[model samples]
Target: MAPRANPTLRQRRLGAELRRMREQVGFGGSELGRLVGMSPAQVTQMEAGKIGISVERLRTIAATCMCVNEPLVAALSDIITEREKPGWWEEYRGTLSEDFVDVAEFEGQARRLTTYSMAFIPGLLQTGSYSSAVFAQTFPPLPRHEIDLRTAFRMQRQRVVRSGTTPYAAFIHEAALRMQFSGPTVLAEQLGALIEDSEQSSVSIRVVPFDVSAMPSSSGTFTYAEGPIPELDAAQVDTSLGCRIFDAPAHVARFRSLLARFESRALSEEESRDFIGSVMKEMESKRA
Candidate 1:
């Protein structure tokens, strides 16, 4: 098959795992290509996610590399088989940046989701109006139509959280609850939605209050998606330039540790609901 102009994060992850397996077995690209009946260039392209690999070829490579991890092999096979499947996020491919679609895809495939937001609410739990207000603050002010498009897309992505199949835990700092990016009315409504979501059996919300003696230092907001296996886990951080996805073992490990710290300092789910309720009441009073 011809090379892909742009490969999704899933594809890249599959490629990385393949490369890791090859390196673990001490096989060079040319050596693995010879064993797998492909040229070194073909192996390189596949490893770079510029080209697709058939499940047959993937299994052959696994066998040749002496990889005994059946679960990892099976997970990789699943990703390859689903490579052609079009997700709901595809509709916004041209209208929105690829990062947006990638994030949605990541969330959809994740077995579990966890996020830490120091300044703003996690996107999965944000209401439409709150999302619009957040998007409006973009440096180069977005056109009204574009802002609306993004807000709509965000609302659609919330379906994963609402599905209640995959477990989701959100650790939000106290500062976010008090930030009035939009008017009090919108914030109040958003807080109300958050409390309602917290009631879901699969949803967990925790708050990190300012009274905590020490805060966990983080570069910025990040969402961590737990894959079918630890090797496939991914962490996504939004930046001024764009969304940055980290799947390297070290990076994912660091993010996991950061989330642990957030949990340690955060209020329990029950306390968080009460805290959010208090904040919502405050917003209601301000609106009055």
Candidate 2:
């Protein structure tokens, strides 16, 4: 598949650029709001991508930014004029959280992905049985239809992973391997899938062993996605307030520091495979 395109931040940056240019011309957001005939808070939201812009507003923004070129005006217009949402996610909109859809598109467009999983194996690497069993236990008395939908969505996520173009690095906790997603058979298949996935030249899978004594990820799962522009890239975490996106350079830098600590503590792909294989064998021994 071609690289996925995520324009959300791009639109925000364009708006921010307009704000900065207006400021450079010595106009505050309120002053620019006067020029655009919109409220200051609306200008702020425009710069933040919380709202879209109309053609009249686009023209006003271009004028306020002292932009004379038709191309610049059209480019910003394109951001708003383009109505088509990515096909992969549109159908699932009502079923999934906004963050979930946003991440899917972001991952599609991302050139690099670094992930850490302390709980169960990260959903991106989960096999169907692992996904189904995880969700089954998650929501009590989950309807069969919901279970099926989640399983399908998870499998679709793995498609790009399997294509091997997106460079993915994962540091998974040792406990995730021992945590039974299903019976021994289901877990055996999941482990085997992880081993197989780790062999891909573009994908790196690491395990943080219990014996490691400590790892940076006692916190929670986080994903750091890299993009063409540094500021446009992001580090995402599911915080107490729920999933939040951090694109600010400092926040992203902090995540980088944490990830470095994690990667350094994790086992290499070969070692991780060996560790999981051992666990699988131990499970078999128990069954025997």
Which candidate number has the best lDDT? 1
How do the residues 1-288 of candidate 2 rate in per-residue lDDT, one tens digit apiece? 222233354566566656655776888889888877888987777776666678777887777778776765675576567677655866677687666666676677677898887778887899899899988886346788988887888788776678888889888888888888677888878888988888889889999998986555345788888865564567767554456767766778888898889877788888998998898888777667
The C-alpha lDDT values of all candidates are 0.91, 0.76
Q: Which 10 successive residues of model 1 have the least lDDT summed?
A: 212-221
Off by over 4 Å in 2: 1-28, 34-42, 48-85, 239-242
lDDT of 1 at 14: 88
Report the C-alpha lDDT of model 1 over 79-103, residue by residue, as the tens digit. 8887466889988887799999998
Where model 1 places Cα greater than 4 Å from the true spot, the runs are: 83-85
Best of the candidates, TM-score: 1
